[model samples]
Target: MKADYKNWMPKGMVTGTGCGTIASLVLFLILGVSPIVPEGSAKKVIGIVLLILTVIFCASTIWMYLMYRAFSYNGKRQMSKQIIEGVASYVSIPDGGKGLDVGCGSGALTIACAKKNPGASFTGIDRWGKEYASFSKKLCESNSEAEGVSNTSFMQGDACKLPFEDETFDAVTSNYVYHNIPSSDRQAILLETLRTLKKGGTFVIHDIMSKVKYGDMQAFVQKLKNMGYDDVKLIDTTSGMFMNKWESTWMGLSGSAILLGRK
Candidate 1:
């Protein structure tokens, strides 16, 4: 059975936008061909505006499709796979030790990490909210089974308040998760994830991490260093790890980076 790591670009958005673009173009054509409106200055202006709207909608639809293709596992770019593999690389769980994956949609990263550390086990958790209704706990488990990753399990949980005790895991990681959460303090959410890692435990959390969404991440990294966390560094993925600067900017992931280190 092939695992389905759904595209980051929602299918509904692409289809809906494509339909609107088609409708706009059809209306423009009908109006131009048939004298549906009187030949006047106002009609001419309306036609121009309608044609502009059609162009805008058409462009949006094309962009969404391109993003979907890039993010798809079967597509040429396989961007999600690159990001997942990058995050999984930092996860090092000792034999008999456990690791945790927050917001583990599809469990792709969790499975990758688990397969890499066969001596250890992993738990993947997510809210499984309506926005990504298809990414349920069952889907994660099924993906693991299909991928032959028996060391991993999954459950539904809130990222803001993980159910496990403090310093419970050997390692912790997440990918492109926290930025989507509507938190006034995204740093707090990062801290929440870090709160569950054992002393000397490694972590890798990837996200858009723009100044507008995360605010002064440099200061936050300094705070972690001050608190004595080891090897704390933020690496820019857009510089070429997962995507280029131009791709990140066009895809609205301009500040994408990986925050990695040990607790």
Candidate 2:
């Protein structure tokens, strides 16, 4: 995509950097006795202008930093709260349930579930795509440790061909991962996830359907239902706080929907 240079930079940083650079250049003129600001009252006016610009730059930088913190950590951001909720809802551990998080970037969802379900053990598997530096495996491990969740472990694995025994996990969750897969291989990934789930277990798939015709969603839902899933539910709860929490462009194009079923 082409860059929108003006708005592309966060307002705070842009204003700060632009103002600071201009101010520094102007300051040099003042010190060097350049003709730009001749020695009289004009120098005062230029100094005030520089001061105002400096303030703008500082404020903008702070605003940009706050925005970054709310959405993501390091460089990876949270998925929409609605999608997180959808995944969490399907992840059940009555006393104890073995859990698997496929495509678990940064281990945010994995760690959270592990903390909440103290009785359950959670495993997060991800290839840690290189789109962002925050997707590093070390970051996930550190995040898990920081959250103080011992039951969660991070591992690198292929989503389309998971390395696990069939019926290994009581609950499985995937968030916005399948859409990135080659369309032909998405089903294979879904089947692999299904294979690892125990009978009567819950599975949650949260992803965007903007690229395909609406009919395609119906067919996909039907396919899951045909696979012996007890109930298939689609829900759109992506708005407000949930929308602002993620950097995903999919949230902007269309809200996320959760496809949940039982094996």
Candidate 3:
């Protein structure tokens, strides 16, 4: 069965755009009324300020709308899905081996991997937070059923502290999730994710890895090398190949990168 992959953009993520559009239009209309005010007065200055604000908000609305279209179009085009799949391709999961998808939002990445590796079983975990109200374990299960993926399951869990025991999964993956976590110890979360993998297991973790958010990722990669990790590399996803810089910056996808390695 072909998977009817749902749009990955969460409702809350687009609320700002909607609000900006409405606010800009409303302000523009109100200012068009030309409220009674003396010429060259403070009120005129206020009007100019409001007009400037309207322009800024209007521009924001347009930019955000384009971003929404990009995300939706990419979803339909399977661009991001392919990117995730590309990252997963580096890993070699044994047939019928267990795999885990951390923070599997709406089960898209999990389902993709499950479809790619039919011989493997996959477990997806997410908190189902209110911010992404449309995503729940039920929705994930339904999507898997629609995709005809029988070897996959969904559960509630945290990325920072996975509920599974050490070396429980032969492979692990996540995408665009870690940065959302409001923690100073982002690297620690990555380490925690690796802890769930069996020795020599594979992992592909993708996220916005701007230096501001993830300090010294190269150093972190070196540390992994020191720990005997093999083929550890960081691939930038925001340049020309996957997504251009403009789109990435507008969609908050800038500095996106995938960290691939074997334990």
Candidate 4:
């Protein structure tokens, strides 16, 4: 079984960054050559300013390229895939239990978990939003089949309102998804996911846990503990042992974290 998962970072991101850098450079060149600037201190200052802007954008474009390379690379060097597999390793589904993957982009995490826990059947759901138009239920199914995973299925569904009964899944997983949702109640989305988890069910949800996006995640974890969740922990995957500082900075995953617990 080969692992063929599309990266979470879109190719357009790199293209856009590169285009911005090019545009800035072109503007700088035009400013340098054109007769718009008078021959004085002002012209030198303007040239210096344009040069600085070009340098900043050029550096930004390079950083974006590095990020794209990190994700698109195959093999062990692919940090995003490694992180997904790392999160999947934390999941423990009982034999023949049903597992659910929320916002299973490209079915990477879902298929990875299914392969790890062959005894468990996995179902992945996503809205296949236009931002990620390449990712569809059919692509997910095909990716699972390509990875030789048979105990997995894919469906279209919304994350804010999952189409499943409460306590229906023995395990649930999601990665880098919730923050993308255009909603103010991010914690509610997490609770909605937890609602589908059966008693003793395990979950490993990874996403950017910036305090701005998910207010006081430590408090949130404590709230889970208060609710009787066992072994609940909020792991800082971005700067912790899973991902290094440079990787996080280059990939713009500085606030990535995993919330794991058993219901």
Candidate 5:
């Protein structure tokens, strides 16, 4: 499970653009050119370029947030805590059973689950290369060690194509990882998850469906039903905190939704 930097293109662009803007601004300030062009050469061009770049930089920041909000849970302060609990409540982790977590970012939910269900072994996969995978891996390992849990493991793998054999896990979970993908490719990921899940096993998906209309919940439910999940549930925690801001603007965004099902 490698962290895919490709998925975070906007975040990276935002950083680069911000740095460029700052550099340009510093250079302009040092030059101290008159507000009006000395001879009306091309000062307006500079002003226009700066303005356009500023707009792009701001928009990129917003796009990064929008991407995060699209799949992340609204409860920024409580997301990691509540998600761990919410997921734990759904599965009765059996002793010695194996579990899988797709895109196990910082390993928060994965480690928490291991702590909650010591009887089960957990393997969390994420490509980590996209953002500090080595650091995150160390933290996840340390978190597990601190809890005295040894049955946990991690690897780097793509969500679109998991590396495990078919029916490898008794339960599988993903959090806010799918919406980043293009809408066209989402079904491929879902079908891949289904292919890996053992019959009668449980699968949980916590992602954002903000792109779809509210009326589509039924269609969404029906789609899962057709996919062979006997039980499907959609939980909206938007009323909690940080959701609206995350969805609407850059600074306060932290959007996420939940969907759980049994395969």
Candidate 6:
């Protein structure tokens, strides 16, 4: 069976918008075509309003469809695969080394990194909350089994407070996760992910680290360097690495970037 890594754009948004669009169109036509409200009345104003709403919904549906296609596995853009492989490339481990994937929805990153380093073991953890009903621990496990990857495991856990001890894994990585967490101190969450990394280990965390969501990320990089991390750098993935500027802006992902280096 093909692994179903759900889209970044939630299904409800598109479906709800499409439904609103159709409903408004039907109401507008009924008000205008039927002689129920008579000419030049308040009903005409309501019909005009509904017509404008239909236009907005139509545009939203088209935009969402394009974005869904871009993020899909078989998409022309394939942004998800590119970003997963890109993050996995940084997860190099020696034979018998262990790795961790925080917020591993659908196990895409964990599976990709596991495939890249067959000799190492990988663990993926997520709360599998109701906000994302499609992603779960079982789904991650099944995807690994389907890919014939025996060295990976999945569990339910929190990103804010990882279940592992400090300096446990040889490598740690996450993609587009931390920002989604509802916390005023998002930097602390980043540090929590880093806390599980062994000294001299590597980390690659990608997310919408816009200044609004994460304040002064460059300063955070400097802080990591001052704290003795080596070669810590923040890279803008929207510069054609995973997506271009236009695509990022179009998809409401303007601040997408990858933070990588050794601890």
lDDT ranking, high to low: 6, 1, 4, 3, 2, 5
Clashes of each: 0, 2, 0, 0, 17, 0
What are the runs in model 6 whose C-alpha is more than 4 Å off?
38-41
User: How displaced is residue 33 in candidate 2, in Å?
Assistant: 28
Error of 1 at 242 (Å): 1.4
Instruction: For residues 1-263, write the lDDT of model 1, one tens digit per residue.
Output: 98887877878889989999999888887664358877888777777877998999999999999999989999899998988998898888889998999999889999999999999999999998887877888888888888988999898899999999999998998999999999999999999999999998999999999999999999999999999899999999999889999999889899999998898
- Cα lDDT tens digits, model 6, 20-85, are 889988888888657876878687788778889889989999998888888888778888889999
TM-score of each: 0.93, 0.65, 0.86, 0.86, 0.73, 0.93
Model 3 spans with C-alpha error above 4 angstroms:
1-4, 11-16, 31-33, 36-42, 45-49, 73-78
Cα-based lDDT at residue 20, candidate 5: 69
Model 5, range 190-250, lDDT digits (tens) per residue? 6687678777788877665564412255467778788778887776645553245443244
lDDT of every model, 2 decimals: 0.91, 0.67, 0.80, 0.86, 0.64, 0.91
lDDT of 4 by residue, 102-213 (tens): 9997898999899999999999999998888778888888888888889999998899999999999999999999999988779999999999999999989999888888
Report how far residue 59 has shifted in candidate 2, in Å: 22
Q: Give me the displacement of residue 46 in model 4, in angstroms.
A: 9.4
lDDT of 3 by residue, 1-263 (tens): 54444455644556776686577657645654356554456656666777777777767667655655555624454455666666667555779799999988788888878888889999999998886777889888888998788989999998888999999998999988989899887999999999999988999988999888888899999999999888999999888657779867877888899898888
Q: State each model's C-alpha RMSD to the native.
A: 1.8, 10.0, 2.7, 2.9, 5.7, 1.8
- Cα displacement (Å) at residue 141, model 3: 0.9
Model 6 residue 126 CA deviation (Å) reads 1.3
Clashes in model 2: which pairs? 12-60, 16-57
* 10 residues in a row with least lDDT, candidate 6: 32-41
Window of ten residues with lowest summed lDDT in model 1: 29-38
The regions of model 1 sitting more than 4 angstroms off are 30-33, 39-49
Q: Output the TM-score of candidate 6.
A: 0.93
